[model samples]
Target: MGLKAFIGKLYAGIAQKQIENMRKNGIGLQNKTFQYLVNEATATVFGIDHGFANIKTYEDFKARVPIRDYEELRPYIDRIMRGDDDVLWPGQPAYLAKTSGTTSGVKYIPISKQSMPEHITAARNALLNYAYETGNTSALDGKMIFLQGSPEMHEVSNIPVGRLSGIVAHHVPIYLQGNRMPTYKTNCIEDWEEKVEAIVDETIKQDMRLISGIPPWCQMYFDRLSAKTGGKKIKDIFPNFKLFVYGGVNYEPYRARIEESIGFAIDTIETYPASEGFIAFQNSQKDKSLLLLVDAGMFYEFIPAEEFFNDKPTRISLKDVELNKNYALILNTSAGLWGYNLGDTIKFVSKNPYKILVTGRIKHYISAFGEHVIGEEVEHALMKIAAEEGLDVVEFTVAPQVNAPAGQLPYHEWFIEFGKAPADLKAFSQKVDKVLQIKNIYYADLIEGNILQPLIVKVLKKNAFVDYMRAEGKLGGQNKVPRLSNDRKIADQLTEYILN
Candidate 1:
């Protein structure tokens, strides 16, 4: 009937067969899925061997195809670098999904009409799976605001071209096609700016609830709804609104701010949103990975952080992925990708098949001398400081730069933007540094060698991340700011323009 019913039925149908496949193969369920995917991946690239065809058999793929990062995807990047339809796989790449990654300067990801369904299905199934778990399927009543990239519609064709928003723009035509979607689909127009504005307008009028997108965009949507309707809080704008779904970026300060702004402790759900795929999600209970969409789309991989990019990356099969272990996330998607390292570190919050926590980005790590620093480490450090300082951090970024003098270990430099800064800010910084140093003996050794020093706090002014993003045009409506930077190039530029 609805999206959920259709997906639920689909999920149920495959689940039983999946169990049987696992039993027959004498392998774990997760591996069974991956094995099946290997079969498909080998098929997708079986005969072809160029940007037009990178497909090789599973064994050949394993031997010939090295695991590639965003930078390694350069050839494919170059093919569609110009957004030439001819370069993409035998179809129109609905829009080029833009993301500012580690190495490759501003690159556009080719998201096709076919790829769109996988993303949509994985995301939709995640929500329904959550609903089944929480017994709150009806909680989706009222308006559901999506805080995605602004629909940057092409003026001539009346479609969208915004890099990040392309993720949704392609779907607009399909969902809104005559009888395919509910009447609500027509609420979206053919204008870039109006896409977000129209969604806002509907929530105010239709009592919207269930907002989804990155944390920053959600806050913007609320700000727009509040400023326009004279209602400062999300509840004030949509009184019937019940749930707020967030992902794409971490939700620390926004969580506190939104909770305070909303009259009641509103429903807040977090998800793992990526351009290549929607990999994992969190539900209302916040018990970590809710339910993984194992059947519908992609085959995943997990390599240990210690060896993710090494000559021989230490890896564990999905079947071997344990609960609460940080592993580099890799995937082979139905959209024609094999052994793709998505460049994010995730932990198995559960092992009942498909579920994980988005710990941090694989590339965004701070190795204080030797103790490898990951996003989770920084998140822990900041959350601890926030709790101690009684501050609600809206957004923050960390940069492990060559900030120290020529020979000293580089400092764990943090640029913090908080809802409240304490009088004893120095104490806060000291505490954070102390925690990190103790947590990793590498920090202690580095401190002994003056290789690593204490955590330095750069208290940013308001809307610091936003200003930095704006300076970089990273704020073009539906984009996000990097949560962590290894160098001061992007980070300092952002801090100078915004936080300074």
Candidate 2:
């Protein structure tokens, strides 16, 4: 919060303003603003440096400084370690948000008061902008709840990586010096065993409404709320809770259970927040997935899956982005990431510059046994099969344990917990296997020859994943379920006890 940092943030705000101005240009960028943006882009392209301070043209930036990844800034992190202004951006960053990438590995994303507004701005655009344009803010009246990570800033860890919890912690309304809860903060449970109890306790204490967070966690919470309140349904406890905002992972399968638990189909809003950026959120009631917050504080770029590997990889600017096209998201935020691959793919559903859809995870792709599968495909198949079985399913995760040779079973261990188990297991398994085959062609071939084994649904004990996360110190706050696995390893380890 020093003057130098203030100046840095001032510059960032100005830079952010210039970028947003480009969006209003419509079809394409106007020449003046475009040139100005390119100039700003060149100087802060990889963060401000006196070494390249004089550079003024986009072509000069391209010719001199090539596109780089997060690792290339090792020297910058070293400078940050010394409290020097070697890192990108103008200010000295204050805190780091410890967050994990799509991969299990973790990184501490750099955050400063200046750069934090990007999150605030994106969130405002998500709510205020939509409300102003469409008169939808009225839905958020009464107590608003955000199912985000705890605001306890970790004292250690200097590596700067972006994650949702830290970002959520950074921007949430704070009226207290202690824990970071929403305005109507009450006695919340920090204990794993007592976490759901605490949520139930708080819900009953206040006229609670307006819920937000990942689907699995939110669903589990209200289910516990319904149970603890004796007969008070979630609809009653949260009568004013008009919108149930969800993000963090693919939510198709869990939506039905959430609606069922609440005993009513409440408003469901979707968002996509990551360590890299608050990529997109539900603008209108019509949900196609992530609607890109184009007017955010960053330069947006997209590279298709096929061209993502070229030496001189090509990218599509915001104005040039095509509809119905799937491309990897690359972000250049004021916090200092330039040309950074966010490890997620988005399909542009409409030409609305501010709206787009999250198709799938670029890193969540599981091909452990040559059966290429994405989260959505697996999710749809499971939902369909579960529907056929007539069971209320809570949460499920898929992991491929083995690489099968042709005609051998490629084990797909599914951990599923249901409100009520289906009367018949054989029929349920057959339906699940068929769902797999119809969804993924490679898996279908694998199943036909027994390369991938018949589906196995291990009905978990209720609130099992929640208990596990609480045990890991990751429950209640901004923690997320292990959505899709890169391999079968984590899914196996987490569910090993209950599976047997």
- CA lDDT of each candidate? 0.61, 0.61
Expressed as tens digits, the lDDT of each residue in 441-465 for candidate 1 is 7766777776666777888888777
lDDT of candidate 2 vs native? 0.61
Report lDDT (Cα) of residue 147, candidate 2.
65
Per-residue lDDT of candidate 2, residues 1-500 (tens digit): 43432343444444445434534553344234334334443444243453345545444444554555555655565466566553565555656666654443555566655557767666645554344434444343345666655444434344343335644655554421122234323323345336555555655666555677777777767767777778566877767656677777776777777777787877666777665566667756655555565544556677885466678766666667788666878776656665567777777776644567676666666677667677667777777877766677777777776755666666776777676677886678778778767877888887777666776667778767766676666775556665467676657556654734
Clashes of each: 12, 18
Model 2 segments more than 4 A misplaced:
1-75, 102-104, 112-114, 129-141, 154-196, 306-314, 319-322, 403-408, 448-455, 498-500
Error of 2 at 203 (Å): 3.8
TM-scores for candidates 1 onward, in order? 0.79, 0.79
Clashes of 1: 12
